[model samples]
Target chain A: MSDAAGDPRVMLRCERLSVRRGRREVVHDVSAELRAGEIIALLGPNGAGKSTLLDALAGALPAAQGRIERRGRVAVALQSPDLARRTVLANVVLALAWWGVPRGNRAPRAREALRAIGAEHLAARPAATLSGGERRRVHLARAIAVRPDILLLDEPFAGLDAEVRASLLEDALSALRSATRATLVVVHDRAEAWALADRLLILIDGRLVATGPPRELLEQPPSLEVAHFLGFDGRLDDGLEVVLTRPAHVALDPAGPVHGRVTRAIPLEDGVRLELELEHGRLYTVAPLPAPGPGDDVRVRLEGGVRFPRFEASAPVPSTAP
Target chain B: MRLIWDELGKALPMIFHGNPQLLDVIWFTVQVAVVATAAATLIGLPIGLALALGRFRGRNLLRALANASLALPPVLVGVFLFILFSPAAPLGFLHLIWTRRVVFIAQTILALPFVVALSAAAIQALAPGLLAQARLLGAGRLQVSMLALREARIGVIAALIAALGTSLAEVAAVALLGGNIYGYDQTLASATLYEVGGGYYADAVAIGIVLIVLILILMCGLGVLQQQGNGIRMRFRSAA
Candidate 1:
């Protein structure tokens, strides 16, 4: 996963970046770098300042106290897909023109970008008449047409259905792969981060808490908050060891050491979800169906779990910008 | 009632056959209106966009000033310009009084507030992120403004139409500034006022009828253009 990030080319570097919205400092003391040909996924809960960080990095918002060095141009596909009332091709071409592409090259570059995202058929259509999915594709094309050195996408797959999201994710990632030197994308779904991102930067409460490969961080989350966000339902402390429990890591086995009584057995499309009452606390894990009923005894074997130390969340530092 | 019908009977032939004097007045009115409207559009669009999107101090004050100017009395505007262009005044050195240029200036002044206010309103109604998105796409200040104007074009067209209407219907300002000269600068609206004051009821009615017909034809033409734009947008909307 670090193969792309290990490249020696640095596209953008920011040091101690702090951003303010009105009087509140939304992004605080963030230092990171985007190397060429790497995809870094920004993950956080709602109101965790993901979009604010992206805006500051894109130079759309003024940094309250930091310096950002960029090697070349940056382009962004914003969350709302703010398109002008023009033809789809014209919208992409307009972006190219703004990036200083020559008039002779704008149309062909725009069309090629649209084709990359499977939106070539919509070139002649008016932007105002596009559907939600079509608008997203056009916006991606607009961002990709310029071949920017750094690309920022703010929830590009938000408000999309599963089928459309899957299809667009595939097409958009492939299109973006060839267009930018480095990419920073904000994503909510962990699977999306795993699928597209070579590395993940987890932000919690306006502070960058962890940065590593998705699987590496998932295996050993340094803090309790990261574990909880990564689908660890609860901690199992049985007086001997403290272990975090996630649904995918627990299984039912008669010879297993951990013991709990089933409180609720809820059937799911793939399996049955069982609520178990352990000696220390209650835990939730999905088990095979037709095995666990309410009040039934179960022994579950855990695999690939880690102990996370309890730590306090960092407080936002006061901005020192005059 | 009998006099009204007799005047209408006399005005009909003049209106139908295009009286030379009436034709000259119509042409002057049209030239002034079109030029004033075009000039107002050029100057008002950027100011209007700034008023909508700028976030500096005293923006609200400027917006309020633009809105309040809509109700300004045309005759008061005429009086102000008259004083400014008087022989003893500061601007009297140019000696532009009672000329077609003064008429053009007065009409533009009268129509400017409509364009600015309505254009600002149109821009404000757009999605807030449109401007920010343009910025994210690497547009400079001028290109961002151009994109904003393109996105809010419908509202801008309406603003132009409103400014044109305001200019076409102006009489007191044209009369005060141009002096309603007989053969040189008299518009249809000012000529109607002059005929009525001289008790030439037939001529006044004829000129008034011509003004209404001219306004109707021009408004209809502009209306068709506006509708064609809307229809093209709707055609794509429904086809999708």
Candidate 2:
């Protein structure tokens, strides 16, 4: 949403960054800008170079081509915290020490940071003794303790339970909101990122396929690759493809064009989701109508339906190398 | 039982009443082993780290060479160093033959592979992704190294202790290079050999007992390091 690449608030910028593993390039020509208070969700499937790009941005991996500029310090909370055999307090303090914080100030500042993350009780505990959730919190504390200008997290909420995942996501976003730190997080779930990210970058096989505000891209993706990744399944029409809207966007209407026989119905807290057998294919849509039995005929109003007449996805995704 | 008691009885006076010759031999042995172990640790640590962390060609070859060195007979290493220090050899220009310096060289050679192989294995056992995470957290090269070394501290201590044990019990190398000269370059191991060859079996047995005691002390050190190492490993498992 914030395309302030040339503004003074830009914290980190990658100008056509390319990263290689051995002799083969894994990230190709990925240009993006992170500005103050901006949260960019980098979404891609497995092996899409999300980790490589995040590592390059954090300066952990070297760029094989192009450049990355940072206005100030950058910190990262990697997937594995890679904790040392030290107490939590000492671990966070070591991070500050690595950033050249003065010896007299290291412990105090680290303690304050741990407190801010609600981990003060874990200060004296060994880092290797913390649970996955606790370790992730400690990692976040360590990253923010240095007061970095740009923060990169590699699947920070990965492997967490649903409740822990939600809590950590909220805490991390709150931390970014409180500071001017620009954060780039690599996530696999597109729907969650769509709702949360101010801006989004969709990568497929190390190539940038789309970048825009998450809401904007959700409503209209520039490429079919992005649309599929965002859970927008489609019927291959001749010149125009019909997109199936999500369950929450579908409604029951007697005068609608699409008709189907319900095969399965699931009740949501606010509405009901139905698995309808349409003439073209099966569609999973939601409606506020009374619970429809398995054999009931239903007419669905497609409130969020979209048509793509300009982009044809008959060929494989092209590599954006040059 | 009688003979064993006689041997211990006959050697006790020499030990308790302060035999300067025996003490000098023991002190010389300890000095050589200590200096050799120190030198081996200082030089082999970096080599071990390189072999463990460095990604390049011939790294496995280096590790293999180090492992092969461990199987090399002490007598062969002794002969190799003896010939290198001989008058006809190029290194003979230093004229370091048949001196305690030569004994130090032999003892260091005998102990070096232990330090390298064990320390490298210890470093390799570090938790994965530690280096990348450290760099991401903004650690410099030295800081990253320090952090990894700290994680592997117990293994490194065990390596040093194992190397010390090897150096302390060495007799063939020191005898070949230093010539077992009494009150000069002679060590506890060499003196034991000297007493055994000279028919003083009781004195030899006494020195042999002392060497066993030294090994026991090292075993105690290894036990302590193991306990500490296990504590950290358990903590790591719990976190996982």
Candidate 3:
């Protein structure tokens, strides 16, 4: 709903965009503006119209209603490779060719594009034979080959290993940052979205529920639905309500407001996540040092927290007494 | 069995010795099939691409019509062409009846539907994701169609071979429309029929043997092309 000039040149503008399939509206009155030099991550649950919105933006499907204004060319890299049964280089070359890049110069340009995505080594392999991660890289290279003003990626990291996913994300983000283009990435992982997105748009049931900076969305989480979406559970205790985000967001302390014994400890790459059962059978996921083993008495606390409204309290609380 | 062996013996010598008559029939079959295939390709590629890529109304009807035409018996197609090119038909003024050209035209029509239907299916079989990718790469309608065709090249080649095979083995259409004039319309199929009618069963059998050999060779050649096309496509994709 912000004006185009307030942000980067509105590369793509969707106003009240709606798409229907078989009499059911899959995308309902969704409006978003993709500005140049910005990366917007469309986050949602499965079948939440994330892919449908990308499809509509890419002009793959007709909008049931509303208008989409695109200032310049927009490129899309689908989750699938979709490359011809051609060599990796040829795939990029073909995309370049499609963009009317002359024949003589396309080879080097294609090579450059492939190199940008670190797929140059795979330039000779059959695209079909490349692993899912490799194919996605090639697809991304081909999309970038056109130097599109707007790029739409649908779950580009779905099947990639962590290293490959990180590399690809870095490559895509770096490229978009340098170019005068806007990118819209659809991802289900909050951590990945947080890393790559400058802005986040959450869609629930085909409706855009929240749009803001990633941290803002994560911190406040517009509503209970959004909080639940952020992987949080709300609990009521002693006429007070507590909302616990993911275990990764919670930290433990001996003198903290909430105290509990560590029930489970799962070691992560950077830190160990502890699953603690607070008094009254309330469970919380938090990062705590010297993590108490299962059955070890430990105190816990909420840090960088907010008041969480209790929506329901029908069940009796289980005693946390040992 | 003796008759069959005798016919085989005679046909082998003629084919090995490069007999002009036998060679002529072989040459004629290849020429007609190739020309017909080419014409069909010209017409069918565009039609198939259009049918598969177009967003217009009645696309399904057009597809159905093309598919239905694939089942059109060669004889019926030949008869239809014969009527059109005959002295009494509406297109009879051109006097094209009983000529190799007439046979070529009839065979092309016979092959056209096969090419269009099969090519359309090949193009249609390309993953929707591929088209979406191409469009996102700044490919317009024609570029997307070309990309789809390229992606389905192996399928297209297979379709081409199927169409060619249908035309090569076709007899009724050439016989009815070609008039089987010696050295002109007298293809292997028509010659075999002629020799059989004249009671020269050995020569008829020889032509049959030659026809079978030619068809086998064509099949082998198509197989090789397909393999090579596949190899090239694989290499190219991997390099990407």
Can you rank all candidates by DockQ, best first?
A: 3, 1, 2
Q: Please report how far candidate 3 places residue B207 from its true position, in Å.
A: 1.5
Residue by residue across A1-322, what tens digits does model 2's lDDT show?
1223467889888888899987989999989888888889999999999998998887778999888888777888888767777789988888887888888998999998887777889999988789988888888888878888888878877777878877777766666554488888888877558645799999999998888998777677666667677776533232344454555456667887778789987888877777888786666776675678789998876666445543555332322101
For candidate 1, lDDT tens digit of each residue in A72-103? 77888889987877789988888887788888
lDDT of 3 by residue, B1-240 (tens): 987888777767766677788788889988988999999999999999999888899999999999898888888888778777889889999999877788888888888988899999988988888887776676788778777777777888888898888878888888888877777777787788888888887778888888888888988888887788777533323111
Model 1 pairs whose backbones collide: none
Docking class of 2: acceptable
B190 Cα displacement, candidate 1 (Å): 2.4
TM-score of chain B of 1: 0.93
Residue A157's lDDT within candidate 1 is 87
Ten-residue segment with the worst summed lDDT in candidate 1 chain B? B231-240
Docking class of 3: medium
| DockQ score of the complex predicted as candidate 3 | 0.56
lDDT of 2: 0.78
Candidate No. with top lDDT: 1
* Per-model DockQ against the true two-chain complex: 0.47, 0.42, 0.56
Better of 1 and 2 by lDDT: 1
